[model samples]
Target: MLGNLFRAETSTLQDPSDELWDALCGPQSAAGKVVTADTAMRVAAVYACVRILSETVAALPFNLYQKTAKNNREVASKHPLQMLLHDLPNEEMTSMDFRTQLMAALQLRGNAFSEVERDRAGRVHGVWPINPDKVWVGRSEKTKRLSFEIHDGDMRTLTPQRMWRVAGLSTNGIIGLSPISQAREGIGLSLALEEHGARLFSNGAKPGGVLQVEGKLSDPAYARLRKSWSDRHQGGANAHRVAILEEGTKWNQIGMSSEDAQFLESRKYQRSEIASMFGVPPHMIADLEKATFSNIEHQSIQFVVYSLLPWLKRIEQSIFRDLLSPVERREYYAKHSVEGLLRGDSKSRSEFYKNLFNSGAISINDMRRLENMNSIDGGDQHWLQLAMAPITQSREPSSSGSSND
Candidate 1:
């Protein structure tokens, strides 16, 4: 038990030039000892965000910072494809999709535009058939400034995540992150206004990270901008869980065999319809489909085994200084194996998981593992360590004792 408190070698996440996609997706290899289950999960979530960004950006605009319907109000977003998003599962929109969309939206805020492309010589340029608004083909002056300010906001919030989604970017794959850790990823999003760099208080410096800044726009416009950015970038623990997917309900919104249709149908452990309360994309819901589930029955056992499970081991290793680690969390022939990772014949996910639970009670290690798995990425990581820091022993009691001493 005491052995669980390990420290991984603190590795800096390097920015691979032209390899932002590679970095966002993940590094080709990793070495440091994984520190703790909590840190492990955060690291994994961070990777997930990175992968979301890498993949989404490479994939394009579909999922970045989509709008969602609040309350009983019917959903509609700024994107022309708003109607399509409103019909998606709420989980898809608010969580995974929401995360990706936030990154994409940040990218857009920093540099969104609708226009034809031209070369330096000012020769004729080809017109893109796609709608200019949906495509993040380039950045605008205002948008760039906003993007920088948004990154500023991230540092100010002191939260590690900076993600986005934009409805106009792509037809699928909604989320993205920068230097991702699960609870949130630190997004180094491309902003529109680079001219006024690092102007926190300097004159003529414009704020990029803010939805609204002092002296930028009128109160009404600023109010709308603030609300819009909030809807676009909201995540973390404070984020509301829009809805949970239920078993036996199929999300057949995109029709059979289409890419959208194939995504949700792949979650074989259970079936459910999730309306994207947020006006994001169908694929966004599918991105982190399994992570949000509270119940074991409908949990993304397969995804946990493949993508997320490794994180736990990494955490355990780094935390405990790399002792007694599993080669991988899921078995090759196990029941919940998905098409991508597993080696052979598959069984029902529940049946596969049931065999592991045959032992009636949970292990001490399992509880520890779960505790770390469920930990958030922000200050909680330091709460215990900070509380236990050593202090100087007092040579004299320097208290007035309420002035009655």
Candidate 2:
């Protein structure tokens, strides 16, 4: 299935033009740094946000589900595409690896593409990821349908059926805008600040300070003094070393500049800003300055709701649209099980289950399944408290008491 997609039998597809390469090179930012998706990753905050989101999404239980007659859904374990999605997307990559790479690409570039390979019977067999850099999206002039031009040693055009795309937030509904491109100024500034801090420490953590002498010295003496000072104090290894002055030379120390002091604060702000841009909570990325025990759990929940849910929905909807045939779409759908992420502490979870069980909203077997425990026999029956009754219902008069009254 994979071999047929890469065969060099293409004729009409054109090579990607130089204009596309220039765009891919990315734009220069206000901080005077080029902020491409690759370069933006060098910033620690960007890397952390991407890693948190991608890993979290990849670790989730992505499964194909079938709608049952009872209005409930069950894992489509017997479906052929179920194995492709749940265990392996292709021969070369496991589900986790494939999802991680695809999600990282979506997070960084705002779009991810994979070629869907189907067997002769029109059943999906494998899915192979294509680098966003190598794929170009366009619409046909006559049909006005979306097409993807892929350049992997050979150019090939694929229709929407063969190409699966998971797009992030989009304005045009056709293509997703890259977050790295949209937030280049902030990210570039972060990269520049990081570079500046590195350079500051690389020079023995000393901004240039003046050395005083009692009298004027010759050019050779001055040169020797400068060389001697650098030899003794330069580089991070020599930082904070005590210097011995000779020949009545006095060392005048320079205080840290205002900009340097603000460097730390600026970096902190940028970290929070980048996290916000990615819809990740500050606590998730270890930015807990304002985080407290009271709100950290809520923040984590918000991360799953506000940050991860949208991305998961996009992937799920894309899977339903791209992987399943028109006939199968009505019956089968893709979903990620986020029940684990949304679970609270053990005590809280116990209370939740208790409430649901008492209300007969969930049975013992359902609770056990949620907790990943084997269900007990006859545990599927739902039960509610028999004593519970509506407030408007009056108690029935006792049969023997009616005569006594």
Candidate 3:
């Protein structure tokens, strides 16, 4: 089934155009393509359809093969895969086929699929393989013959040394776009994916380290460690989470006298300094020092990350597991729904939030402050995404009278 779509889409493959060659250089190329203005319009429509389908399908239990999870009774039987299963239930139709069609739609729109991954922290991270968005940083390579500049949008290099960036895949290591490729800029690239953007899994992603990312792991050996950490941390599923919290609280009681006080009170501890502080993990310092609050962008990132640390891995699994029970799946749906409502507007203003009474991730007020901090960079189309992005919201309380629910 997928083969047909691939054949049909590339059926007209003439020699690759210079424009096409330049566009699909590396990791940013995954977004696909947009040949005509009409293709853009069609792809926009398809993009929406695909997103809805992706979410619905992402939530399905594998054996059921129904993305709606026995609940979306009136979804009108959407999704090509769902329909294929419903009508034919034959071996011919495969997910590869669905993917081919999706890729065609993306290519038609001039977008490429670059890799994306969620970290153990449930923070979204990704690199551009062929970005029409051009939000990714451009790497400059000066050759003796000519200076060919590569950005996230360009992936395939004429030269062997050019990097093979992957889009739509969860990559942790910075893609080797070029010797001049900026890792920090790639970190900014990672920041672009926003909240649940990363496709990684691990309990500990200390952002402060001088990251020497070589590649992204579609599946890693430590994936289970991330699961273990995430359940206890992200979903409150950890067997020892209670013990960790108790120990943490006990340590917090005496402030500077605490055993972990070393993480906080040193003369050099400052928010801007955390990223550069040699070996200290940013989260450790953020929790102990709480000094990142001074910088709005950093503060929100700190809070959002800190708030979700325990649950990161769990959220990572929850975000894409086809194994959730119907009830469990619905809960995920409802929570994201409310978050979506908040996020869709892209302009929620509040000093802090009082949520998370149940998750026990952090104190409600503290969580709110984190939310306020994270809201700095707007334009997340959904709420949980807003939860991940930097907020420009103030530390002052909200007057919008949003329901606590």
- Tens digit of lDDT per residue, candidate 1, span 1-405? 111112132211222241353335442223222222123222322233334433333222222132234522222244222322222313224223432443333332221221223345432122112221232211224333112112212221111112111222222222222212221111111010111122312312212232213344668965775575445434343243342323332222222322433432433211112112112222333545444434432333343354333432322222122111143222111111122223222455335334433443433343334334553334222111123333565355667655653
Writing each residue's lDDT as its tens digit, candidate 3 over 92-193 gives 434334334323333223223323333464322322233323222222333332111234444332221222121221232222112111122322222232
Tens-digit lDDT string for candidate 2 (1-405):
122222233322322332354456547787889888999999989999999999999999888999998899999999999998899889999999999999999989989999999889889999999998777776665676777888888878898889899988887776777899789899999999888778777768777678899999899999999998889888899898888887999988687763757988999999999999999999888888999999988888998998899999999998888888999998999999999988888998999999999999999999999999999999999999789678767777567646643
Point out where model 1 deviates above 4 Å. Answer: 1-299, 322-405
lDDT agreement with native, every candidate: 0.28, 0.86, 0.30
TM-score of each: 0.17, 0.86, 0.18
Name the lDDT value of residue 17 in candidate 2: 38
Question: Comparing 1 and 2 by TM-score, which wins?
Answer: 2
Measured by lDDT, the strongest candidate is 2
List where candidate 3 sits over 4 angstroms from the true fold. 1-161, 164-355, 373-405
Candidate 2 residue 49 C-alpha distance from true site, Å: 0.7
lDDT computed for candidate 2: 0.86
Lowest-scoring 10 consecutive residues by lDDT in candidate 3?
174-183
In model 2, which regions exceed 4 Å deviation? 1-26, 209-227, 242-261, 390-405
Q: Evaluate residue 185 in candidate 3 and report its C-alpha lDDT on the 0 to 100 scale.
A: 30
